[model samples]
Target: MIVASVPRTWFEEAVVVFFDVVRGTRAEAGQVLLPDGRALPGVRLVEGEHLAPGAVYEAEDEDGRRQDPERLRIVERRAGSDPAVRLEHVLGDEGTVTVVEGALQGIERPVAAQLRGSVRGLGRWGSLRRVHGEARVGLRAWWEAAAGRHVSGTPFEARLEHRLAEATVWAVPRPHGAGRWKVRLELSLRGRSFLRPVAAVALLLFRNRLREAFTDRVDRLAQVWNEIVLDTVSQDKSRLRERILDAAASPPEEPLL
Candidate 1:
């Protein structure tokens, strides 16, 4: 089973704003937050690609050549201003599209785990179930912390309110085995307009030091959350892992059958 989630139109627009800001940063340095609530060195928005707010990518094939069809288009703007960074992406099906705005792309980990964990839990009943359950709950809590609550006051303060996102779960089912699954997770943002507050906060708190500080903040957030995910998967049952390998070795039959 594959469990996927994405935002609507405004979400896409918000993403555009984010990229625009990042581009701005390229032209000049700006303020950004650190995990310790202190400001870090500033930086210029350098580069970006098909990764926008509310989007994820996976190496579908062995060589990792195949990518998700819903490729995210990226752009950067507003690097010199206080909230001097913006990033954007276009999401959803061809016609009915939506925009998501946030500092940058960050929400693939948990999505992968959720997809795999759900399938694994169905086949076996033990630690995997617990791990997935804890992850699911944690994701919700993180969402509330970053996305659900609105940080009011100044525009910068408001945007800063929801810069980070909860973890997402991902899963890849073995085409050949019902009981086999591969699970992975990462922290990701859900809210569409969260970038506004994040940019706002950077301007207020970091002032002109937003560039390097923002990059540092994003890096630290990923490192900490990645550690959490790695620790959780440490105790993964060998049997389940074996099952996943077996399924991978023997893929599903062709549709012609």
Candidate 2:
């Protein structure tokens, strides 16, 4: 079983919201209503619902692979002033595990103290996370600086490195007193570019507005690229087939009046 806890603060809420947006669980039109009445852009939200205990919830992405919701847990409601919610999960006999930790240790340091400020922002909980050599995984995340900055498409050059300091996983045998096998997992990501001055000005002028715009821009940009490439390829393929057919056809040797 795996168990953990996280603060029930705005920052944590932001992370959850971001994931939902990326996963298409929440949409501006159907579910994810902004404080204002305007509709947000990017990916469209299709369906979402929480699972009850003993109930099975399954889903599939574009790849058509079935997903298990029991793998992840969200502590929606809390009882006390602990400020943090605990998370627990069980790894079945034939299950894949991918855990994320070390958000509190400020990411990682590359060369000098230049990376300190952003690292300090994630909070000093830990510095690493990992899993055994049992699965093929991919990590996708969009993070802004604590100073309120845009990390892409702008000219600013400031960088923040999110790295894992250490990671380890252990497996237990059937016998209660049996020994365990363990291995270390290494994960690292650093050097995120940001638009410092422009970001600052935008943040000063419009608080969370900058982050919201950034998210929308990223999503739309991806969608546009996908459409453009698919259209271009389709046109090129049609032209190629037409040319081939014309060349393969035989023409009359004599001209008809």
Summing lDDT over every window of 10 consecutive residues in candidate 2, give the lowest-scoring window: 107-116
lDDT by residue for model 2 over 1-257, one digit each (tens)? 11111112323433333333323322333323332322222112233443212222222333334434323333232222222222323233233333321112111211111111211211243232222222111111111211133333221123223342222222111111212111112222222235445544654777566457655764575466556434433344325333333322323232100
Tell me how far the alpha carbon of residue 130 in candidate 2 is from the true structure, in angstroms, after superposition: 11
lDDT of 2 at 109: 16
Q: lDDT by residue for model 1 over 1-257, one digit each (tens)?
A: 21112222323343344334333331212222232233223211223322232222222333323333323323333222222222232222332122232222222222111111111222233333222112212333233323334323211111111123223333222122232222222222232245556645655776546456545665675566556444433433434333333333342342100
TM-score of each: 0.19, 0.19
How many clashes in each structure? 72, 6
Runs in model 1 lying further than 4 Å from the true structure: 1-62, 80-86, 91-96, 102-257
Worst 10 residues of 1 by lDDT: 111-120
Clashes of 2: 6
> By lDDT, who's the top model here?
1
Candidate 1, TM-score vs. the true structure? 0.19
